[model samples]
Target: MTTEKETLNYGPVLFHYDLFPEKIERHGKVKKVITKRGTFALKEAEMSEDERNWFTHVIQRLSEIGFHQVVPLYPTKFGDYTVQLGPKTYYLMPWFASDERNERAKDEVLLDHLGKVHALTLKEQDFSNEVVEHSYQYLMNRWENRQFEMERFTEEAEQKTYMSPFELTYLSHFHQIMRMTEEAKRRLRDWYDTCQREKRYRSVLCHGKVSRNHLIFNPSGEGHLLNFEKAVLDTPVRDLAVYFRRAAHQRDWSIEEGKALLDLYEKHVPLLNEERGLLISYLSYPEPVFNAVDLYCSKRTQYSQIELVHRLESRIRAMKKIRDFCDAIMIAPPPSMDENAPKNIHIHDEEDHI
Candidate 1:
C-alpha cells in the first residue's frame, strides 16, 4: 500500500504528468509509481539543465537513427520529457517487472545490444595532435599521481611497528599491484603512440554505465535499455572496459565467458587495433583496489579491520582474474572490419550542444 506521506511527497512531480500515485515503492534510484493510469518507473537523477537536454537529445537521436530499443521517456502534459522539482529531476517510463528467467542470458544480450549501438554510431576521426597529446598526458599524469599516493600509503604502513590487518594485506600485494599499474601504463602509451603514428581515432556514443541492471525485459520478452544519463561521445572501448571490469568482479564470471561476450560484440563492430590496446590499458589498471585503500583511509573507523582486509582481498582477487583475462586477449586479433559499418555519422559541434 502507498503511504500518505510518500504520495504527498511525490504528488507535485507527478502532477506534471497527471499521475497521482496510489503506491510509491523505492527501488534503488527509481520509484515504482503505481497509478490509475498504469505502473511506471520514475527515475530520479541530479542533472543540470544542460545534462537533461543532452540526455533527451541522445534518446531522440538514437531513435532518429533507427535504434528504438531504449526505454522511452514519457512526456508531461506540457510536453516536457522531464519534470524538475527543486534540485531533483524526474523522468517517467513504463515499469517492466524483473524476469528471473531472462537473468542468466542478460550479459550476452547486453553485449550484443551494446555492439549494435556502437556499430550504428561509430565515427572515425582524423586525429588532432592537440587532442591526442592532451588526452594521453592527462590520463598518464592522473594515474601516476594515484600510483604515488598508493606508494606513500604503503610506506606509512611499512613504518608502523604493528600494522592493521588491512594495511598488512595491502602491503603484501602492493608489489603485484604496482606491476599491474606499470603494465597498464605501458599499454596506454602504446595506444597513444599507435594513434599518433596512424593519425586516427574512433568515437561512439558510449552508454557510460553499461550493466545488466540497466536492461530489462518487456512483456513480450524483448530487452530494452535504460539509464543513459551518463552517455557520452568517447571511444567504444569506454563502455566495454566498464562492463568487463565490473563483470570480472563477479565470482561466477570466467575468462572464457568474457571472451565469448567480446566475440559477440565484435561481430557487430570489430575493434580497431589501437582501440583493442586501449581497452586492455583501461582494464589492466587496478583502480578498484586503490579505491578500497581510499575507503580504508577515510572510513577505517566505520568498518572493522577484518572487513577492510576482506574488501581489499576481494578486489585483489578480481584484479588477478582481470590480469588473466587481459593476457588471453593480448594477442587475440580483431575480427575483420564490416563493409557496411556505419560511416558518415554527423557529430554536431560542441557549441551546438553534443
Candidate 2:
C-alpha cells in the first residue's frame, strides 16, 4: 500500500525511510500502520498549547477508564502523550484487523457498537473541568467562526460566482446548505447551553468523530472505535449523532432501526429523551459541515485547483443526497403511527441552523 506520508511534503518534518518500512491506510484523521510489532495507527490533530495539555490529561483519563473497543497507545519512546511535529501533534494506537465488511448491517448495528463504546468509557470517567469547558467552547467557536466564513462563499456576487454554468449551479446549492448549517449551529448552541443549565451533560470523555471510517469490525463480531484525536470531555451523545450520520448515508433506515440502535446503546449507557434530541441535532447537517470547511480551505487558483474544485463539487452532491435522506426521516418521525404526537418534526436546511 502507498502511504500518504511519502507523498505529502509538508516542509521539514518529512517522514523518511528511517521511519520504518510500513504500509498504512488513511482513515479519517488517523493513519494506520502495519508493522512487526502489530498494526498501529497514528492520530494527528492540531491544537493550541493549552488544548494540547488538556488533551494529554484526557488521554490519561481514558487510559484510567480502561476504554474498551478503543485503545490508547502510550509513546514510550517520546515520554509524552503526543509528539509535536511542526504545526501538528500526533497520538498513536494499536491497529486492529477485522473480517469482511458488514455492508448489509443496518444502522442500528453501528449504533449498538457506538453505544457500547460510549457506555464503557464515558461512565465515571473523571474528565477535568478544563477539558469539558474547552470542548464545548471549541465546538461552539468552530461552528460560529465557520459559519461566518462560509457566508462569504455564499455571497451572490458576479465576480465571486463560478465560471461555468454547472459550477455556478453547484455553488448556489452549496451556499444554501452553508446557510442552513449556520442556523443549525445556532440551535446546537441553544440546546447545548440548556443541557449545561439543567446539568444534564456530565463532563465525560467522548469520541468527537464517531463514523464508519474510524471503526473496524473484527471477525470475532466486535467493532473497534479508533481515532481519539477529536476525543474530549463532552456530552456522550455527540458521538451518537456522528455515528448515525454515517449510517444515514446509504439509505433511510426505518425508525425501528434507529430505535434498535438506541436500545443497543442504552444497554451500555442510558440516554434520556432530551439527549436523543441533541443527537438528532448533531446529525442534522451531517457531512456537509466537514465538507464545507475542507472546501473553504482547499480553494485555490492553479494547477491543483481544478482537481480540488471537482472534489468540492462531489462533496456538495453528497451533501444534497444526505440532505434529502435526512428530510425523508424528518417528514416521517419514528413510530409514525403514534397519533398523539405531532406527525412530523420540521427540519430546515439553512446555514448555522444546527
* Model 1 whole-model lDDT (C-alpha atoms): 0.90
Each model's TM-score? 0.95, 0.58
Candidate 1, 1-354: lDDT as tens digits = 788998898899999999989889999999999989999999999999999999999988888777888999999999999999889999999999999999998999899889878877877776799999999999999999999999999999999999988998999999999999999999999999999898999888899999999999998888989999999989999999999999998999999999989988888777888888899999999999999999999999999988999999999999999999998887777665556644433343443223
Tens digits of lDDT, candidate 2, 254-308 = 4456555655566556554445545545665534545634554555443265566
**How many clashes show up in model 1?**
0
Candidate 2 ranges beyond 4 A from true positions: 1-66, 72-95, 101-110, 121-148, 158-163, 171-179, 182-186, 189-193, 196-199, 217-221, 246-263, 285-354
Clashing pairs in 1: none
Residue 24 error for model 2, in Å?
9.3
Q: State residue 62's C-alpha deviation in candidate 1, in Å.
A: 0.9
